[model samples]
Target: MNCGCDEQRRVTVSRRRLLAAGAAGAFAGLAGSQLDTQLAFAADPAYSGDVLVLLSLRGGFDGLSAVVPAGDPAYYAARPTIAVPKAQLIGGGTFFGLHPALAPLLPYWTSGKLAAVHAVGQPAPNRSHFAAMEELERAAPGTSLRTGWLNRMAGSLGADDPFDAVAMGTARPARVLDGPAPYLGLTSIDAFTLTGDDAVKPVAATMAALYQGAPPALARTAGQLTGALARAKALRSAGYTPANGAAYPSTELGAALRDVARLIKTGAGLMTATVDSGDWDMHENLGPAQPGRRMHDQLAQLAAALAAFATDLGPDGLNRVTLVTISEFGRRVAQNGSGGLDHGYGNAMFVLGGGVRGGRVYGSWPGLTAAQLRDGDLAVTTDYRAVIGEILRARCRVGDLAPVFPGVTASSLGLVATR
Candidate 1:
C-alpha cells in the first residue's frame, strides 16, 4: 500500500514537471527566446547545403510492389497474386526492377539523379501505425530524448529563421518538427495570414498596437505574427508560377511541393520541409500495375507529383535539393486473402537529388525465403536512420550526426556524393 502511494506521487510529480516545462516552452516561443537569442549571438554559422525534404508515406508502404526484386524468386513466390511482373519494371538493375507505375521517374533515374535502398526499416519491427510513426519521428531509440530528430537537426544548426524548417500541406506541425526550432506550419503560402487581416482593418496591425510596449513575451509574439503576415503578403503579391515548363498535378501533394519550390526559389533560408501522402494502406483491392487499379492509380499520383517537383526545380534547382521518402513501416511480403498486404517490416527508401547515385538499388538484398523472414516479415538488413544519416552527412553537410541520430553509424552506400 505504501509503495503504491509512492508510485502515484511520483507519477503526479512527473506530470507536473512535464506540464511546467511545456508551459515555459510555449511562453518562450511567444517571446522568440531561442530565435531571438540566436540572432543576437554569433555562435552557429549558416548551413550551406541541400534543402532537405522529408516525404512521409503515412500508411504502410509496400516496398515489394514498388522496388520489385525481379531476381528474387522467393519474392515472386511470396506475392504470387500481386508481384510486379518483370517485364513491366523500369530502371533498376539485374537484381531489382522499378514498378511500371514509376515510369514517370525514369528520366531522372536514368540520368543518375534518383536512388533507392531496399530491406531498410526501423531498428525493430512495429506493426501499429501510431506507435511506429511516433517512434519513427522521435528517432532516438533506447534513450530518453523526446525531441524529434528533424527538430534536433534544426536546433543543432542554430536555426532562428522562421522559414528554416516548415511543415507544408497542413496547419498542424509534423511530429518530426516538434522541438524548439523556429518553424511554421502552413496549409499553403497564400493561406498563411492572420484571421481577420484585410485592406480596411488589418488584424495584424491591430494586434501589434494592442501589444505595443507590452511585456517581452506579448510584444515579441505580436511582432512575430505581424512579420509573418508581412512576408506572406509579399509572397502573395509576387504571384508564383511553376518554372521550366513544369506542370504540377492538381493534387494536394503537388501543391505542397509547389509551395516548397516557391520558398526555395524565393531564398527563404529553407533548411528542411516535411510533406505527407496517405492512402498507401491498401488493405484491400490493391490491384495490378494497371491504370484502373488502386495501387496503380496511387503510385501514378505520387509519380506525377514527384516528377513535377523535379521538373519545376530543374537541373540547377535540384542540384541543391535532396528529397527522401520514408514510411512508418512496410507491408507484409505475402499478399493476404483480400489481395493486399498488412503491416510488416523492412521497407524501402527512395532518394532523389543531383548528388544521388541513381539507376541502381542500394543495400544488401535480404532474401525472402520463409526461413529468412522475421516472424513472417522481411528481415531488416539496414537501419533507416543510417540511411538518413548518410544523406545528412553527405548532402546536408551536417558535420556531427551524433546529436541527431545518437550513436548510429551512417551507411557508406555512396547513395549521394560527399560534401
Candidate 2:
C-alpha cells in the first residue's frame, strides 16, 4: 500500500537520542549504575571520649612470672628456678616484685597509673585453647554465645550510629567484636575505598540500593559505610608517621598497635579497638631466666610499643585511651621438665593509662599450694568481667554491664582516677 512512506516517517528515531536515554538511566542508577558500592561494613564515627583500646596477649601468659609475689614464701618455694628477685624491682613495695623483663612498666606502676589484677579469668575450667579463648572472647563463661562482648557493649551503648565499635585485626576475629552493627574492620584504614570518582557515585548508589532491605547486620553496616568511603579513601591516600622518635618494634603486634595509634589520632569513632599479640604459650622452651626463652625480649618489645603509644598520644591522648592486656589463662605454679610453665588458671590483667589508679596490684592473691589451686591452677579471686565491666560503666558511660557480659555482675576495683 501507499502507507509505507508514512510508516517510515513514524518509525524514524535518532541514534544520539537513544544513547542519551540509556546514559541518563545508567547515571540515575535506574539501569543500576547510580549505586554500586558495597555497603556491608566499616566506618561509624569519630572517637568521643568513651573509647577502649583492647590489647590481647594471646597464648597462656604466666601471671606469676609477670608480677612476682616476693613477699609470699609459697611463691618462691613453688618456683625456685623462675622466681624474680625482689631486690631488682624499681619500686620498694611489700610482697611484690616485677619480672626483670617488665622493667618498662615500672614507671607506670610507680606513678600509680597501672592497676594489675592477679588471679583473674573466667571460671571455665576447660583448658583447651580454642574453647577457652572463644569463651573469653564472647565474654560469656558458662553459656554458648554468638555475638562478641564488644558488639554487645556497643549495642548497649546505643549510639545514634553503630559504627563506633571497631576491631583492629582482620575483618572478623573471635568473641569481642561479633554482632550486628556498623564496625570498621580494616587492617589498613589506608586501603579502604569506593571505586571511581564521579562515575563511581552512580554505581555506589546502585550497590547501596540493592542492599536496601537486608538484615545480616553486615548489610545495614554496609549502608552506614557508604558515607565513609570518601573519608576512608582520603585516609588511605595519606600515609601515617610516628612521633617523638618513637619507633615500633618489628613485630606483628607492634605494627598493628602502631596502626591503631594512627587511626585513633585521625579521629575515628573507634569506641573499641582490639590488637592481639600471639606467641605467649610457652610450653616447651619458656626460659624465664634466659634472653629469648621466657620474658626478656618479649617484655621489652611489649613495653616499647606501649611506651611509644602513650608518648605519641601524650597526656591528652593517653587520657583518652584505656589499654587492657589479657591472656587465655595463666601458667602452672610449677615448672615442667621442658623448663617452661604449663597451662594453668588465674592469670593477671594489666590496665594502663592516665586515668587508672595504678602503682598498686589490686585483687586478693591466692596461694600456690596444692589445696588452694583450682584444678592445679591459681584460684580466681577477681573476675575479669568485673574489672572491664566497671570501666565500661564508669569511663565509657555504658552503665549496663549485664548485657555486654550476660548473667554476670561487676564490682568496681576503683582503678580509674578519682577526677
Candidate 3:
C-alpha cells in the first residue's frame, strides 16, 4: 500500500468532474433521488489501500452448469445438452468441471487466485430477476429493505475522492452501489475525463449552481464529474496500454476492465468498482462449439477479462485486491425443450486474489437429485451476504454487517485470502 506514484500534482478543477457529478447517476430515472448538498468536494486522503472490485453476472447464472457436477448421474440427466463433459473441462474431477469455454480461467485456479462456491445463493428463492437482483444489490437477504448496502458501505468508508465507489461499465447504475458513496457509472475511460485543455471554471460554476437547486444525486454527480474530468486530463498524458502483458478481450468488457486496471495502478483511490456481464440466462442451447455457443463466448470473455486484470495488476496488486463475481441467482437443473436452462436457485460466486483460499470450491454442494432442488432449482446452502460480510469485515475492516445486510445473520465462508 505504499501509494507514491510519479509526482501527479494536487488535482486542479476540470471538466470530467462536471459530467461525473452524479455519484448516483446510474439511478437517475430509477430509485429515489439523493439530497443536493451531499455534493460537496473532498480533499485527498493519505490512504487508498484496501479495494473491493465487484462483478455482477446478471441473469441467473448456472452454478451447477458453470462448474458441472459430472460425478453425479443426476447432473448429466439434468443437463443432457449443456452439461460440460469431464475430459473437455479444465481438470478431470469427480464433483467439478469448469465449462470448457472457461479455459482462460484455468491458470488462475491452478495458480491459486480463483476460488469458486458451489450451491451458493441468497436466503429466499426470488425467481423474478428484478426482485432477486434488488435483494442482492441491497446486500439485504430479506425483502423489507431500502437504500443500497454499498451506500451504507460508502457511509462507512467515510470520504475520499467521492470517486471511492464507481460503476465502471454500464451507463446504468448497479444495485449494490445504491447507497450514499459518490459513485460514477463509467462506460469508457475517455468519457471519465474532461474535454478541453484547462478546467472550465465558468461552465463548472454554472453547472454546479444549476445542480445546486437540483436533487442531491444530481449535485453530487456534477461535482464528481468535474473531478473525473480533471483526472482524465492527467491520465490522458500518461497514454497507457496494457503493461503487464495482460490481454483483455478486444470486446466491450475488455475495454471496461482495462480502464479499471489503469485507475488502480495510477493511484486513484477507488474503494469499490463494479463491472457487469450478462446473457447467462440460457433457457436453450447453452452449449460449446469451436467459436463456442452464447454461453461459451460469454464465459470466455468473462474469464478472459478477469484473468487479464489479475495479470495486468501483477501479484502485488492481487495481494491488496479481492475480486468477487456474483449472479442474480442460479439457473434450473433441468434443461428445457429449447436446449436451454430455466431460472433456478443456488448459483456460485468466484472470489479471486493472491490471498484467497484458492484451489478449492467453498460451500456445501447440495446434490442435484429430486430432494435437493428447492421447488425445482438448486437449494441454496450458503447465503451470498455471508460472503460479502466476510470481505467487508476482514478486508475493508467494516465490522457491522447489519447495516449492509439487514435481518440475516452473516455466516462467514472464509473464502477470502486475508493476509
Best by TM-score: 1
Model 3: per-residue Cα lDDT over 1-419, one tens digit each: 21222211112224454345444443221111110001111234433435677777877887775677777888878766767767777744557877777788788888777888888888778889998888788765435667777667766666446453343222336666555556655555554433244354456446556777677757766666556555665777778788778888886567667877787777655666667766677777777433557777778788888889888888888776788888888888888889888888889888887678776678888787899778988888888877877877777666677777776565567777444
User: What value does the lDDT take at residue 253 in candidate 2?
Assistant: 56
Model 2, position 156, has a per-residue lDDT of 68
What's the candidate order when arranged by decreasing TM-score? 1, 3, 2
Stretches of candidate 1 above 4 Å error? 1-46, 163-172
| Tens digits of per-residue lDDT for model 1, 133-163 | 9999999999999888988887777676533
Across 96-188, the per-residue lDDT of candidate 2 in tens digits comes to 666766666677778876678888988666577878888787877666678878777766665435233232211233456667643544334
- Output the TM-score of candidate 1: 0.88
Worst 10 residues of 3 by lDDT: 29-38
Scored by lDDT, the top model is 1
lDDT of 3 at 190: 53
TM-score of every candidate relative to the true structure: 0.88, 0.79, 0.82
lDDT of 1: 0.76
Off by over 4 Å in 3: 1-49, 141-144, 164-172, 193-224
RMSD of 2: 13.4
Ranking by lDDT: 1, 3, 2
